[model samples]
Target: MAPDPLRSATTTDDTAAIGRLGAVLAARGRPGPVALGPHGPHLVTSVADTRRVLTDAEVFRFPVDVTRRATTGEHAMVARLRPEQVARGTRTFEAELSRATTGWDGGGADDAMEVLRLPVARSTTDAVLGPLETMCRDHVADLVLDWVDSLAPIIAATRPPRRWSRARREERRARTALERSLEDLRVEQPTVSAVELAAGVQVPIAAGAWLLVLLAQHPQAAAAARRHDLAVEVAWETLRLRPPTWVTARMTARSVSLERGTLPAHAVVLVSPLLLGHLPDLLPSGSAGPEVFDPQRWVGGDVRPGSWLPFGAGPHACPGRSLGLAQLTALARWAADRHVVLTEPARIDQTRGIFPSPALLRCGAVPSSPEE
Candidate 1:
């Protein structure tokens, strides 16, 4: 049998093949949590299986050839904020999030949500990015969105370092923005953390926007999210349905089987967080599981351990997840208690990095419900 060309670019949706990936996991010699396929065999899917692979670096590895090449000379940028750096930045980020939505009287919350979303980029910039963190919300957000925007075209096109020039330009712009922020590092940098420094803060800041987008989708869910009730669970469900990264790409470390069959070593792997969340073993009753949006499941131990990897697993998990969640919880908690309506429905594009950015969410103030 010949491999299908549909799954070539993990960044692009080439076919409906993803819908049938679960059956592949259960078939053939593939067992033990990992499943390799004739088409997308490179990816490792099981929660338990991935736990093993992620924990054991020697057996599995993320080929950084592309990442390294693309990130050339950016090591210092990454190393600047050490573990504490990431922690402190998260703290600073958290404080700001708390400061933003504090003392709300539950009146005109829908309007407040809209106002906040409109200026989110700049507000986020103030927290993470330095001075270049433009106060102009929409345009600032546009700049960030534009950079990720190039991702699809880059992957879809053919040419060696073909997208190199474009990528470099984006990097240069980002670097320049960082350089501006660096000028006042002593004063501006004290609160800065590794995540802020490494990700330029905007990367992680984007999570808030995403949660807002999802909240807009389900009035009830958004209300639940706003109250920060079992926020972690809500966050997990959001990850399941609208994962930041629609697909995860990893370079094979050694020739291995998907608990199923033979697969070549060093193969490019695509693990869909979207697909992983739907596994029956992990989900009590599939995607429609009772705890699907219930945060209580996690609190009551109904939640499966090592089964969810919204921030991902292993060395590459998103470090700023805590900060993102904190902000999300506060926002969710606030919104749920008030009368809110997402006036401007968000337009989302998942083709960006595994973490897709919601391009827009126009908000309008609405009267609070009588419950408030």
Candidate 2:
């Protein structure tokens, strides 16, 4: 096979390493899975293989945590988020975001990631934490955000930090604090609630920030999305181009034979929605091509939005998928009419899950609503 042209591009841009990796993999012109190294850790790029690797838990297992072995035997359960909860969360996010952006007047720039943290945290808290006094709910939401922040260093490290390291210590402190708070509230399964709140709050904040950055970069799409229906389409396109959870990993439970090749036991396997989103066959053909951002390709609904598995697929898929989509759609609607402009070039931050770094934007004056 010929060397991919994107290989050079990948090396030059440190910020977009993950994205460039996906691009290079997609450009290889292979119809099957590709290996990252001769020894193993293969990349599953094709749609069928991606689905098979993620959906088959027996053969491909989630990475085992030796520290959590005590709870490993418990059957993992995913709580189904109710429709009413999603609706309530969406409303809460919109209101919170409106409050967060109140002072913008195109006079100064704001970091999208920083601006979005509390609103996303509070919105997710309201949806998942159940009824509580307003003050109590807000306090819990704040604690969750603190816990999420403390986790960044631990997650971004090349290897697991030592138990006594500063990163690990900070994370332990945050987790203990949040767990105690949840217990005080009489929440069932405090450990589970902590995990849910962290996942629910953190992922959406990254997603929402990306939506704003993409909107600011693509004014034409933003203008078209002024219509509510088009805004929803824009949300789908943002997720397609840059799903926060861009890559996921699974370990082979035992030696297995796949259509493409054979893998030894305990080999690490990877699946990436980012790479799948770049495949021409998986997306609708457009004048601009799959690599370009064009929301109109989804107009006729010819190709389903999630064929690339943005939120993932199968039994282990994100349980808060509906609420996450609703939150992003609401954000798209809010940004549609606003003249949001980037103050600086946004770089991809892949230390943890991918997010926009220094996602600074200047907003124009808000237009009065139709009812106003």
Candidate 3:
């Protein structure tokens, strides 16, 4: 079967091939808006077009109803966090990853998703909720994962599930569990709401898990990370290839002119960070090899990151982006410090956000040098 652009972006074992496919589509199609499917939304293909859509909130409003319902209100929060708070969260992430992975000795394989689950869950919980008793934090973490998992089917469905449907029922149950757990925390910190906490907790888990999967698939990048120099670059490279929230949708509040044609009002506009990452114009010259996992390309810093907007853009952009990057960077470093090898092929799971399911890996801790 020929590549499906959406699936190629969302579910792929070979990123390079899929990226090539995206590039071809971008080049051959009209420079402006392109129809995604027979009757699906229109996709904005160019970086300039994407930025315009994300920034011009007056013309392109966030499809809040779609995102909020798919995520069960967890996507509602958008509080901007300070640098100090993000630093603290980074510390939490580092500590949790070290503790969670310390027991691994490369003696057997472990599921990357399972290994990252508790560490990411706890780190995000601590970052947003502050220090709490182990029991309370763990309880909240479990609830957040439950809510995140339940929303997966709702997001993947072609049509929204009915109120009485099993998917909706499960999502409601999970959200209730999370809200109940947040009650006490909300009372203590009224300004920092539970919705904010949920957003912080859920996204990191998915992103962190993807970080591990990428490291396992690309041993060279993983080795660079272990050397203690490429953690940030590794994280950025991974985000470029496999952003968790790969596609974001917006509704055209009013008619908007584009390079190719005019978009009608109320038209659903699709902007995919994954697709943008594959665009040659937005990348460093001669470094447009989107299929390869090469962190060294970021060394010179000629090509600015965030052009793809992995965490999104404009007023509704992710407030936790810095924190998310810090957390993923820490994970990259941790993976670098170990000799991680993939135990099985990783496949993309697109039930909600994109992540590598069954990302089984094995690792042995890197011995410290005498100089250290």
Candidate 2 vs. truth: CA RMSD?
Answer: 4.8
User: Model 2: per-residue lDDT, tens digit, 212-278?
Assistant: 8877766665655665358777778888877888878788888887767777897888888878887
What lDDT score belongs to each candidate, Candidate 1 first? Answer: 0.45, 0.76, 0.70
Q: Write the per-residue lDDT of candidate 1 for residues 1-372, one digit (tens) a residue.
A: 112112321224543233434343233234433435565545555565555555445545554322133322121121232444334444444555455555433333333322343233333444444334334423444444443333334443344344358665665465445444344444334223322433343333445555555555455545544554656665555555445554555655677655445556766555555556656566543234522443334544644632657666655555445544544555555445444444453433333433323233434343353233
For model 1, the stretches where C-alpha displacement exceeds 4 angstroms are 1-41, 64-167, 176-206, 222-228, 284-299, 304-306, 343-348, 354-372
Q: What does each candidate score in C-alpha RMSD? A: 8.4, 4.8, 5.0
Total clashes for model 3: 2
Query: What is the clash tally of candidate 1?
Result: 21
- Sorted on lDDT, best first, the list reads 2, 3, 1
By TM-score, the better pick of 2 and 3 is 2
138: Cα error in model 2, Å:
1.1
Cα shift from native, residue 82, model 1 (Å) = 9.6
In candidate 1, how many Å is residue 189 off?
14
Candidate that scores best on TM-score: 2
Positional deviation of residue 209's Cα in model 3 after best superposition, in angstroms: 2.5
* C-alpha TM-score for every candidate: 0.61, 0.89, 0.84
